[model samples]
Target: MTTYIPSLTIPSVVLQHSAASVLLPIALGTAVGFGTRPSKTQKTYLALKQPPLRPPPWVFGPVWTVLYGVMGYASHRIATIGLRSSASPAIVETAQNSLTLYTVQLGLNLAWMPLFFVAKRPSEASIDIVTLIGMNAYLAYLWSSIDEVAAWCQVPYLGWLGFATYLCVGAGYLNGWDLHDKEVKEE
Candidate 1:
């Protein structure tokens, strides 16, 4: 009788090194954003009174796609530093903390879509976005200690977060979204 053995498949270097630390977040974010972007959300967005500097809706996808790619690359670089043979204990701790915070910020990023689009709660979205901007800035500082170029790469993401924060605030105000009352009718 022949026995069948299942072999465990180990992740490739690229997958272990970059894809998990980098691409996973981007892919998850993209999937969440795309999945929640239904026609109701589109109509709500189109009907909202935008801030003065709001980019066209079409601009968001491409910009985010590029930003996500850049963010992944930056994260990959940081992860590589953590994998160094000569890495000190403190360095490893810092890298681990930075990566953990990065994941938190990514969660905050994902939270915004559902809050704004699915729940149709601009006020809540605004608050979430504000927190995201702050966390992102802190993450940038943490990444700076590990990789200067990686830190610099997050600048655009920060700028975009700032802009998104502005938009959220504007949308909340223009729509008369009461934070305390999610069921309040739009003005």
Candidate 2:
């Protein structure tokens, strides 16, 4: 006997759930990450020797704004599917794990800016970014099993994470800062 899996079909209710379920976290993370950038942090970022393909600082805000919005929708899609398929324990379990992974990645995303820009420690930021990339990959893989569109939505986010990793590694290497040093000198 062969078992067949059904593809998820988007329902009209997704429109209702997308805004609150998706946008809220994306907006909150974006606000906290960008809001924490003070003049000192800006200066620190400017002083760093960026990687070869690093885009101008201005590009990040806009790029993240768009990416976050799309990410929210994609997440909402998965959530809606899970809710509709609540009768199936296996599907519910997968959905729960999927959302948990998304939340973990977002938390890491929120933490990166403060650690890198505000704290002026690219070493820690590098570690966070690396973890973020891994989480993103895992999320994408898990999401693909349930929803191909949702999985594809993470493409740009994944690409940006790669670029961010390059930037973080470059900054950490060039600065030669000691991760164990607890002292943060004011500029």
Candidate 3:
């Protein structure tokens, strides 16, 4: 795996502390959630022809909040514990690479709402989520060799992403791959 990508990787200094690392994703996720306009997103969500087993719209907020925190802590663990555990250059490089992938996956995670709700593009949203799942799965695998706790922390996130992928694709299929028609206007 590549150790670093200037664009995709967050600088190590910003995430050096445990609290900063843990709060980073949570804060970003919250901003994205609000920035996309939740009322509009919720309206759009309800307007769609949803697939079976879809959770109520309210469920997403808490679930994502928790997932973001967990994933953030996982990244912290990978960066600190993983790095301190080994003096080897390869291990240090892997930790950096894992953090890079974490940032990339986070971008993908933040993109889903805008794609699905704001842009009203279910097909693109589904594709984005599928890609997110694949990237995070690989990320978790990388984390395993560095920090066991960090690797384990990703299990819930990976599980949730699997279910979310199903929801995205299923919603797309149910709605004929077009969320544009389902767009709801606010008063």
Candidate 4:
């Protein structure tokens, strides 16, 4: 009988240098936000209308983990891109503009957790959701302005936020829209 030897296969290191910088903040946001507050109900609700193409609940964790990693590193890539670029002034200006928008949106993305989970205010969360949606929209526009590869990374996030907006709107209405409004007016 002939003995067979098996070879181990190692995956190629396709990730670029900028991957860590871009994805770090995203991962930080996730860990900080989730660790600060647990939202069992919210997670379930968010998954309610999840598209058929979307991954399962368990899949979200790992997928987002990797995505955020890429995002953080990619952000660093963009930040340094123009700094070291030998390109024209116009090109550098474009890179600067893109980075500004990306950074701003990332802040807004990070803000959603506090508004939604810690505050436990669906109405406030709904407003934040709208704001985050707009932020993502601007980020998308900025991505298109800078590089397709970078902008494409946000597609899954935007889609989740889209469904999340609807859930927040529904929950906001369900929780109490006018109660807080009346109190605000009284004050």
Residue runs of model 2 more than 4 Å from their true location after superposition: 1-16, 178-187
The lDDT for every candidate, in the order shown, is 0.73, 0.74, 0.85, 0.56
lDDT of 2 at 108: 80
Assess candidate 3 and give its lDDT: 0.85
lDDT of 4 by residue, 1-187 (tens): 2122111101012122465565556566777657754455345334333323544446545655665665655555455554345756865666566555555556666666566555556677777778877876776666565566666767777777787677567655654543222221212
Worst 10 residues of 4 by lDDT: 5-14
Candidate that would win on lDDT: 3
What lDDT is reached at residue 66 by model 1?
80
Which residue pairs clash within candidate 3? Answer: none
Off by over 4 Å in 4: 1-19, 39-60, 177-187
RMSD of each: 8.1, 7.1, 2.2, 14.8
lDDT, residue 33, candidate 4: 51
TM-score for every candidate vs. truth? 0.82, 0.81, 0.92, 0.65
lDDT of 2 by residue, 64-140 (tens): 88888878887887787764644377776686677767776877888888887767777888999999989889998
The 10-residue segment of model 1 with minimum total lDDT is: 1-10
Tens-digit lDDT track for model 1 on 5-105?
Answer: 11111122442366565666668777987788555556667777777887777787778878887777777777778546688887777776776666667
Task: Tell me model 1's lDDT, rounded to 2 decimals.
Answer: 0.73
